[model samples]
Target: MSRVAIIGGGVIGGGWAARFLLNGWDVAVFDPAPDAARKIASVLDNASRSLPGIYDRALPAKGKLTFHDTIAAAVEGADWVQESVSERLDLKHAVYAEIVPALREGGFIASSTSGFKAVDLGAKGASVVVVHPFNPVYLLPLVELSGPADLRLRAEPVVRALGMYPLQMEVEIDAFIANRFQEAVWREALWMVRDGIATTGQIDAAIHMGFGLRWAQMGLFETYRIAGGEAGMASYLEQFGPSLSWPWSRLTDVPDLDDALVATIAAQSDKQAAGRSVPELERLRDDNLVAILRGLRQQGSGAGEVILAHEATLPEGGEIDGLPVTASRCVPVTWTDYNGHMNEAAYLELGSWATDGLMRIVGAGPDYIAAGKSFFTVDSRIRYLDEVQCGERLSVTTQVIAAEGKKMRLFHRIMTGDGLVATIETLLLHTDLTTRRSCPPEPEVAAALTRLARAHDGRIAEGCGGAVGERP
Candidate 1:
């Protein structure tokens, strides 16, 4: 098992530990603070509940977590070392000095420093790269990386394996890319609050209710391109470029962090948040992010596309009784209806996924579809015997009912952690994509299907081969 050493137990450090631990990497954490362990545990609890919710598939079994008294102990035998100590240069350097001797030779080192450039971190002759991540690191997939190309290349696969997108910088600069843009907005917001132009809540509302939505999907340039209408980017620039000279923004001025300004911002923020605690707000943020990401998953755009691509690479489900556990997942909040139970359409969707799982089992997946031979469902019957609520775990088991020539029949049982929830029976016909007509599956697929069919011949579900009807 790979091991990572985390040198800090603050929010960012704890987030890093959670990300690594959840991804099946044994983690060693070293923090001198008194409540470091409890703090890390809190972060882990949030991460455990939120990170896996974003994916339809299960993450790897969690790795072992160990807390150490010193940086040397944490870095010992570790494959990777991540420093998230205080941003003070002396503190960071001191931590590095103690860790370098214990760090495994050839192992990678990363710093979660948002304010410092990679070059600055390496000035002490330590080979640390900036692997700066956003808050709730386990949920947000963007990690800004800056360092020597060799080190960046080594870190790319590791970061990507954690379901994060590593954006390698060509030139090192203070604050990096995302934060530079963020700083500009933050400075302007501070000025607005100082000048009494807008409250914190109103400023936040402006983003959350408007361009934030656009930025999440299309980003700035594409959003502007769309705003260009028929003419495109050049026309957009022609129309809006003059606004650059307008005094609409206060980018150059700095807001004094005085008592009154601080109090106003704090009071406004408190009012905006109402009575919700930090943990409550974190959960709210995570849920909204999950919904947005899932929506983008449908379009296969932006961060949603990243998740989709990552999902494609996840390990396939294991088997039960020789048949694959086709679909195992937590029913997302969006899948439930007003009654608080999973909707009718969701049953069919799960059943469809089970059918797709069967297709994969029989060697008829993406390549088969690309090769113009695929299964098309012609008939389906679903029996919802019990209700499943949001956040409940669900698993689907498939039984091959029959497989002969171009025709295949399958039955799926959808079970919750408590008991069986639903069953679906489907009849599918192999088809030639070009001709749009029934066609015999290739020999490999046919043989695999036949094998499964024979294995499940006498194991049919009770609700299989049933018609939709009311009890008399």
Candidate 2:
């Protein structure tokens, strides 16, 4: 039920809006430009399609979004006010001054300014906090928090709630941490282009095809730590320390971005785009990010850990068509095949989780497994009824079939808004984990499964008992 007021509607502002709105914050946006609404809508469209794919559970229900003509109307009763206007000091100061009088008593202003220090930004004595986020705010989890210690403390929970990392800055400096590194690399890249040493495409490939992958998981210093062999970090410093004195990078030099260089860069960038619109390019980037993030999520590393933590806080399960919902989530890009629809293997994975869900309902969850009693799936059959695309929200409902002494049967329907996409019929046997052999379940779990079986007895399942290629 929390509300956020967004001032500005450029790329960064829209991205902030999308992140907060999708995370279930009521958003009020104030942007003077006439096309701001359309721009924000496009960002939201991309965000809604990709952000939730990073998590196992669904994000919170989307909250209300309202556009206002003035900042006062937007900031009234707001829990957090975000200022993402142009980088001009005068403009930001004006926005902050207007925001303070109307901001709720407990609310604070968050500036998306990348380089401004809090001391300068808070000249008006407003409760301003620097919460600069990266491009595509909904997908990138890093947000630099700098300002009043109390205000920064207040912002951490809110940032975590949106599945973002709040990397606190004990000392505020220009451009913060991540962006400073980015600026250094950018300077080097620019120098390379100016020197005619590399084209935009080649430089991009060098990063994406090489160290970028390393950076995604281990980051810079850790990657070098591995490079140090068995000697570790101190050895790394010894090996690379001398190179710092060498003139290897032009980080300190400025490249003349004259018309010729600008033209060359623009032309190369257009070729790289290959006729894709901005939105199209954005979708491609988001898909790649989702695929990479999900892989890292499996390892629980870096930003993937942020996603796992937030997903744990999310509420799970509900009923659909009077059946207990087992697994519900948006299809991630990783689940799709070359044919561009969900692969057959994903259907099996869904069924497996649904089986886990049913076991949990029958008092045989992770704790039961830890206690040495659990269910092991011996066989399963899936009948895919329709195509499922990436980003589609799927709800799986499980229907208990039979719960005899040592065996349990479940039927799962994987559905989208259009209708059922697949049906899974799986059979499991109760097993003692310690012995790794089949066994009868505890009395309570057995009785619970029996109750579910009796409740679903009257329901017809056409796809059950089917062999390969069998049709109902």
Candidate 3:
């Protein structure tokens, strides 16, 4: 229960606040604009919808939130302070001066500075660390930390406690990790357009349809390593190292921002974005990130690891409150078959989604699966009660049916928006993470199963465990 103070309430600051608050840290915020409250409200609205949708278990009760009229009041009891005021050095310096005296000695202060160096900012303080977090702070796991060597050890765990994976830079570098990598691409893209090598859309297409897919999963070095075959990283570097000297673009040089080039890029970007507003694009981006990351969580790879790490922190089965609800999506066209209905495989997919939700409730999830244990389907009895056609919306409700020793049974129903039952079923399981055998659940896990079982003890469907047709 550390108290976190978010010093500004713009998009980035509000995202930081959402991440900390949802993770169970009390948060206080200070923002001077009269519309600050409204702005943060909008940001949190999106966050509330987006954050909890990524997982099935409930988010920890959001830590209490308070708004402070002054900087001192906000930082008064804060154990960690995140300064996300405007990037101008003068503003940052003023904020540091205002809050420094109130910050407890050894209490951490991090500047979400995308470019400014902590040492160069010259803000005199007891301790300071540069914690450069990207936009959409709540979802992105990467945070690059740089400061004096001694301060890093103190900062790393604080970052981890906030549920971020911190990459400590041995030598402080400009813009840290992801941003620097982004800047390199940006510089090259600009050069390409300026030199008439490619249209704006073409460059984006090349990346998004090409290297971007590979980079998303494996990243630059590892991707190249895979390409190296049996030779490994050293061999890959040796073969490609010569190309580095013959580069078509200069990493160190800044591209000229000529009016003609700027207009061409801007017009192309406008076309690329269509008519979507900034907020619309932001929402779209978040939705895609959530869907992609959630899928990865199931596979136990990629950015899904962040979701998996979070799953480990959840309590086992119990009454959970304040979990945010996400928007529902229609079954994708790809899921439909020649018969114009969701294919048989997609039925199992929906059932798997239901299982993911149930597992989260019972404290078995990605991390647990990663640890070499998980609930695997031992038996299933599904009935297609009614027809569900392509493009139709679907929702499912899950209930624990029975629990005894290592085995438990779960029942679920898939329904249309109008409450027509399209499908119904029971799934029986003996979870086995290792050897993939039918093994009994661990005591803690069994206890969770038993509690869920008792909650719905008498409410079982017909043909399910002899508890006929009675549904809760």
Candidate 4:
């Protein structure tokens, strides 16, 4: 879709805008709050690093964002409207009323309300879908989808197009999917504090030290299935089922919000989270999640696998300019090492830089590089055809040897002078940024490659001799 309108430009709305814009969908933001622009800009900055880190490839061009003074103007010609207003029912009703008058009949509306059921909002519009996403929306894949089944069916592909998973809730329920899970854990933790059986630190330690790690890759049921050992989930469930009658859990009981209990929990939580500001904690979380998910992606498992598949559908290098160089970097001073020559890795780095420059030429640039879609080196055959002392000027040239769907054969030559060919030849594959797996370039990108391939057709890469196929 060409344009998406986001209402209530708070954190969730801003995040939604980032995801869509990164995927090449133009966005318009509508919020009466004067600070909406600043909030969205911050969201985009965070996403620039976080989103790109997950994928080995580059994303599509970020779409143009417009700030509309009125809701009507924002909704006009919008293919989708994402609402992220306050959680109160009255506020949502008012926002919905304001939104509906401006929205076209077929335009899709997704509410970012955590607890509100889609049915409540659907009465106002036939095409409304409740799409509640977790915090750090660009990185997190889970999005709860509930509403008219038909509306959800229509909305799922759009959600997928933005590199997110649309989880369908079988029935409309308050708190939807994740919040219900959160409430259950919250209740148990509160009761532990009321009884003085477990400190907040103890509870947090228990989770982060154990289940949290498992949960990152496998959900509760899958984890239990493994714990079942030889028999599987059924055998484990049958063995554990008999213990259900025991008073093992006080999960249903309510804890009074007493001052002493609150203080104890709060103090313990503060101690457990000591020495880290919210932003620092967020960075730590992002780092850990990226590392873990990236590992899983390499293994072709868990959420990493799902994200990998989502990225596969993204365009490799479209008609705009060039293939995005996801691995581009300037030569680092440290890369010179002890020798006067650039380190071997640094040669690879320069080659990557040249490839990126070529990508910009084909059309993909910073904006397209943000969406988790781009190209990756499958194999490289570099020949140190010539080596000169460090501190000399250097550059690289890239040519498309062959382009067929997701696989493109690239030949790169690094040179110290315009006439000399220093190093060359890299075979590449179009990859989904999320999955880090090979995928065919999108049709538009492929078409552009056909032209690029022809332009670079009959030429052989300058240096393709010495032990050429080694990875840097």
Candidate 5:
């Protein structure tokens, strides 16, 4: 198994440990802090509950996590070392000094520094790349990588394997890319607070309730492109470019974070928290992010594409109780409802995908559909058996009831660790996409389906042949 050593055990460090461990990398950590293990454990628990739901496929089994007393003990056989110590040049250098010699052959180190130049970091001549991740590292995919070209090249694929996107910085700069923009926004937000222009809650509302939502999906330029109307980005710039030079006063000035300002900000932030602990807030943030990402997944846009792309790489197909396992996935936040369970419509969506899965199993996959033939659902009956909650993994196993000529029937069992949760019985007709009429499938596909039907003959599916509420 691949191994990673984590230095420090603060928020960022703990997040890194959780990221690596969930991706199935054995993690060794060294931190003298007494609560380090507890902190990492808490992060791991939060991560475990949320991260997998963002994907339609299962992540690999979690890895072993061990804490060590000395840095060397953790670093000795590691394939990669992630340093997330406090943002002190001397402290970082000291950690690097101990890490370099202890690294196994071909091992490298990545610093989770929010902002620090590569030259300054490698001044002591130990090669390290800046791989900065946003908070709640397990979910956010962006990681800014800066260092020598060779070092970055080596790190990029590893990050991608963990389902993260690596942003390569060819030119090293202060604070890297994301934080620079953030610093500008923060400076402006602070000025607004100092000038009493807006309170913390109002500023937050401005973000999540407006531009922040826009930014989350289309981002600045693309969203502006819409504002450009019939024209594109060029028209957008022409219209708004001149306004940027206006006296957007106080940007050049710094806010005085004195006692009053700090107290004002602190009190407002407390109100914003509204009695939810930091961990509770993190859970809320994670749920909203999952919903947004899954929304994007439907359009194959933004971070959803990353997840979709990664899911394509996940292995599929298995059997359960003599039936073919057709669909397996974590219930996304979008799939839940006010009832605190999977929505009724969401269950139909699950059954639809399971039908698709069964198609692939019987020689009717993407290529077959692309060749102008596919199954069209004609009827479906679903019996809801139990509750399915957000983040719960659900698997659908299909038992073919009939497969003759242009008609096929399927009974799907939806299961969780708690046992069978739902059952769907569906009927489908093979169709000619061009003719838009019922038709025979390809010879091979027909034969395969027939064989499957024969194999499943004489088996009893409890809810098979039942209309809704018949209780068959």
Candidate 6:
């Protein structure tokens, strides 16, 4: 197994640890802070509950996590060393000086520095690449990679394996790409607050309620391209390029970091946040991200597309009792209803996923669908036995009850840790895409289904063929 050494246990460092550890990479963390272990553990708790909620399939089992007192102990035998110490050049340099000697031979080193350029980081006489990751690193897939082309290329697979996107920079620049754009907005916000033009809450609303949604999917240029209407980007530039010379933006000046200004900003931020604690705020943020990403996943656009691609590469579920464990996932916050349990629609969705899994077992998957042949549910009856709340783990065990020429029936038990939560019985018909009508399955699919049906014929569970009120 690959090993990653984390040189700090602050927020970013803890997030890095969680990302690597959750992805089944053994992690060694070295931080001098007395509460470092507790801090990292807290981050792990949030990550464990949040990261896996984004995917339909289960993540790899967590790897071993060890905390060490010294950097040398942490870096020894590590495959990758990530330094996330304080951003101060002196502190980073000191950490690097200690880390270089302990780094395993040929192992790569990365610095989670947001401001410093790669050249500045290399001044300490070590080859450390700038791999700046966003906050809540376990969830956000984008990581800015700035370094030599060779090192960046070599590191691409490792980053991708962690379920992250590596955006390599052609030239090493301070603050990198995303942060440069962010800094401009941040500076402007500060100026607005200082000048009493807008409160923190209002500024936040301006973004979250408007362009933020557009930016989440199409990004700036593409979003504007759409705004161009029929004429395209040239029209957009022609219409709006003159605004660049306007004195509308205050990015040219930096807000004074004085006590009064700081206190004002702090008070405004407190008012904006109301009574929610940091953890509460974090959970809220994560939930919103999850909902947004899932919506994107459905459309297969932007970051959602990234998630879909990564999910496709993940290992399929293991089998259970000669049949596949079709569905296994945690109920995300969005799946809950006003009744405080898994919603009715979600139950049907899970059943559909189980049916899709069975189809895959019979060689009728994406390729089959692409070839204009698939299954369409003709009827379904769901029996909800127990309530499941958000964040609860759930699995579905499927049984093939019948499989004939063009028709098949399936039964699925939705299970929680304690016992069964619900059951779904569904009837499906093999379909022809062009005609939109029932059709016989392809030879290979029919044979596979026949084998499964034959094996499961006598092994039907007690609830098989039962209506809502009728139990055998």
Top model number, lDDT: 2
lDDT of each: 0.86, 0.91, 0.74, 0.74, 0.89, 0.88
**TM-score for each candidate, following the candidate numbering:** 0.90, 0.96, 0.75, 0.72, 0.94, 0.95
Q: Give the per-residue lDDT of model 1 (tens digit) for 313-399.
A: 766678766667998776776677889788999899888888888898889999999989899999999888888866566788898
Candidate 5 at 187: error in angstroms?
A: 0.3
Model 5 TM-score is: 0.94
| Weakest 10 consecutive residues of candidate 3 by summed lDDT | 318-327
In candidate 5, which residue ranges exceed 4 Å CA deviation? 466-472
In model 5, the Cα lDDT at residue 469 comes to 83
* Higher-scoring candidate on lDDT, 4 or 5: 5
lDDT tens digits, residue span 1-472, model 5: 8999999988998988988888899999999999999999998988887788888777777899999999999998888889999999999999999999898876667999988887789899888899999988988888999988898999998888888889999999989989998888889999999999999999889888999888877777789999998898889999998999998856778898999999999999999999999888988998888878777777888888887887787767789988898998888778888988899999899899898898998889899999899999999999999999887888899998999899999999999988999999899999999999999889999988999899999998897886668763
lDDT of each residue in 301-409, candidate 6, tens digit only: 8888878877877776676666678888878777888897889999999899888988887899999999999999999988888899887778888888999989999
Candidate 4 lDDT tens digits, 34-77: 88899899788666656655654456667898999988898888
User: Which TM-score value belongs to model 6?
Assistant: 0.95
Report the lDDT tens digits of candidate 3 across residue range 1-472: 7799999988889889888887788989999988888887777766665666565455666788889999999999898899999989888888888888888866757888888887865556535688888778877767888887777777788777655778888887778778878999999888888888998889989997899878766788899998777999898888888888896676788788988888989998899899999899887777666666667777877767766786666543322122211113345444567886667777767777777777766777677778777777766766655566644556666667777766666766666657645334555566565576777776777888788777666663544543434443
Q: Model 2 clash pairs?
A: none
| C-alpha RMSD by candidate, in order | 2.9, 1.6, 6.7, 10.0, 2.0, 1.8
Candidate 6, residue 119: lDDT: 82
In candidate 1, stretches whose alpha carbon ends up further than 4 angstroms from where it belongs are 337-344, 370-373, 378-394, 404-407, 415-422, 429-444, 460-462, 465-472
Clashing pairs in 3: 373-433, 462-469
